[model samples]
Target: MTRCLRRIAPLALALCHLAAATPAAAQESAAAEALFDRGLADMEAGKYETGCASIAESHRIEPKPGALFTLAICESRWGRVASAFTRFGDYLALYEQMTPDQKSRQGERAKVARKERDRLGPLVPELSLSLPPGAPAGTVVKRDGRAVDGALLGKGVPVEPGEHVVSTQAPGGPVWETRIQLAEGEKKRVALQVNGASTAAPSGGISGRRTAAFVAGGVGVAGLVLGGVTGALTLGKKSVVEEHCGSAIGVSDETACDQTGIDAAESASTTGLVSTIGFGLGLAGLGAAAVLFLTEPKQGEEAAAATSRRIRARVLAAGPDGVVIGARGAW
Candidate 1:
């Protein structure tokens, strides 16, 4: 009986130790979950700042990032320029995991983007127009839809007869100068850009996403290398522990000496594997960037070709509203 008791004592004690560790781990996880939920709620409400904080805290525990994306969109709507930049991070994280199948679809998306990017250039206001008889009243000069303060009646303001530009500054956007012309009547139309690298002429294929993938993938690769080193060192520690303690280390002894070595090895191995994945992701990102760079111009050319919309009118009139009088022409 004494011998049995002695043998069982260590096992029971170890069990108790393990049991004590469980609640702490559970509590930590619960806290992380709570934070994540709160972040999700904030994101839905468009409270980006609060959402970001909650998500970041939760991420430390769970290491996920849906909340970060929600926050970025909210910030963009509010015109929070700085936060918009932070939102880009969420896209970068997700992109690192894209497979070849996903990347293959990028070309199609790039084509559409390029088409829109160069849809129009700065409006060149037409000069020396002969005003027709009975030109309609309330003919407001517009460049893209706002009031062009102090734009000259005789001075140049870009137009294409269907777009509007009512700006005080230079119509600073691709299609910044509109073609919306007023016939002394009125028209309503609105178009949205998919917000590429912002400039009057968008850098069609930037998508801003490729750059992020490149950076994150690089970081992941570096982490892999670091993890590999750590794993190697931990293995050495494991050797030392086994040499000194033998199999007894994991038996009823539970001296904690071998525990350190085991923990080190586990941590190193886990991180090392993760690091390799990161490294691979990094390389892929860089490669993707190269691909995107080469692809954009091709896409842009296609888009331009498509937009070569020619006009073929049998007969027409000439007026401020475009041949409002008697004329015949082709576009």
Candidate 2:
């Protein structure tokens, strides 16, 4: 019992001191005053939206109806009547709790303040939030370094300066986001961008490449034609020479004609051999060019060059195209 008492006694004493040290109501009022001023400052700076939020918070903590009315009025030029009506009810309740002297002072203050503040009540065009395209679905958009959830798409209402965030989500779609800063009375369109796959390939790409291959094959055929022409010419020249040589030998002894026939026949045979080789080689070269054009840039080239290059994600379902490849990476 003594041991338990010792532990409990210190805790009790600490609790008493803590309560004595903290004046909850006074502290709350002080915080409300500070928040109220912050909202006013934001308003002056053209951050009406942020000002509205701050002022609303101040009134919530201290039940300051005048402050709440001023907030509702200035936040959207008094357009938030629903909020003002709600706050007014609470304000009157708190007003009833005040002493006679407090009530008198507030009434006098209200007369002067309301006259002036009335004109400024209701900030025109309430502020709202939004996101952009290409953002991942279900990802939050950031503004001023803070994340905002459920930012709607399209242009949002003007915001107070400093920063704001828009949160976004799209089922089976790219997440979208956008950040914006607004000054008082500033209006602007916020665009939302989303990212996703392209549905169709570009035109005349593979087709053009295939056309080139056909053109190359045609050149190869031309080479064959050249070979045939040369071969035919050689054969024709040699046949003519043989006929002349045979005729000359039978009719008369002519050494010069015989020598001419022999030379012509040998020249034609050499021509045929050269033409055949050239035709074969040209066809091979054309084949090689076609292969190079049809193939993708090699993996080696991809690995070596990684600076701001275009990247694609593809899933192959079957056969040679259906392989999963991974890269070694460092972050």
Candidate 3:
């Protein structure tokens, strides 16, 4: 009696669990049927977008050959040739797995699906992709944001008619992207290339920034020396003018000067102008040198080179009248 009761208790629990799940299953079936009906109504009203969406949802809730076939039809009328073709193939495949009685019921729909799939086979566009010679190994290719199989490379593969984005990336290389458009029944091939070489300076070497800094420093020192020499010459000329023309350093009495005094004053003015220009060049060069040295990149020669390329310094000696020196950069 005790053994019998144990067996019976297990059976009772199983039955109770089945009963509890029955209502949920029924609810799902009801919802799927409702969606299917609504989708059909929408498609008949020429609203393919909403109709297809509803039907797809209904198929997701409860997969059925009828719903899939209807969805294929909706997609066909909506001009999604690739989608319609794939869905029709799916319906035919599903029909093959149905039981004898089920197959009998779905035979007509299966025939239509096969016919449609065959009709679209020639209308679908094909795209072939190939890598350029010397392409790096482990390169990844994608079409429309989906990964493409390596085996499909250089082979014509079916694609939907319209615009598509193709992208490729190799190890340690920059991503390459291109857009392509195809019409129905069109076939096209594309050759992809990757720019993988680094543009940075080589390792274990002086960076561009350092080189620029040295150049700027040298210019600064030279400018300073020129300014000093020119300034001394100006001072000597000024002394001569003062002695001959009764002109002090800041005060010039031209009426009290003869030709020699006037000549001395002119020489002093020209030398003073050269001195001023030299001083300006020296100051600007030194400032640029300081900034470059302080902001030099520490990553590597390559990074420094990239950073230095953005910075530019120009110095022009405009025939001793004035000197122009300035630096421009991104940051």
Error of 1 at 231 (Å): 5.7
Where model 3 places Cα greater than 4 Å from the true spot, the runs are: 197-331
Task: State TM-scores per candidate.
Answer: 0.26, 0.32, 0.56
Tens-digit lDDT string for candidate 1 (10-112): 9999999999999998997899889988977887787767876787687677664343444444454444433444444445545457687764644443333
- What is candidate 3's lDDT per residue for 1-331, written digit by digit as tens? 9999998998999999999999999999999999999999999999999999999999999998899999999988887788898999998888878899989987588778888999988888889998765567788899999989999999998888999999989887788999999998899999876667222333234666788888888888888898999899989887777677644333465557767778988988887887887877777678778877876766554455575566665563443555555667684
Model 1 TM-score?
Answer: 0.26
Superposition error at 211 for model 1 (Å): 4.9
- lDDT of every model, 2 decimals: 0.47, 0.56, 0.82
lDDT of 3: 0.82
Residue 75 of model 1 has an lDDT of 51
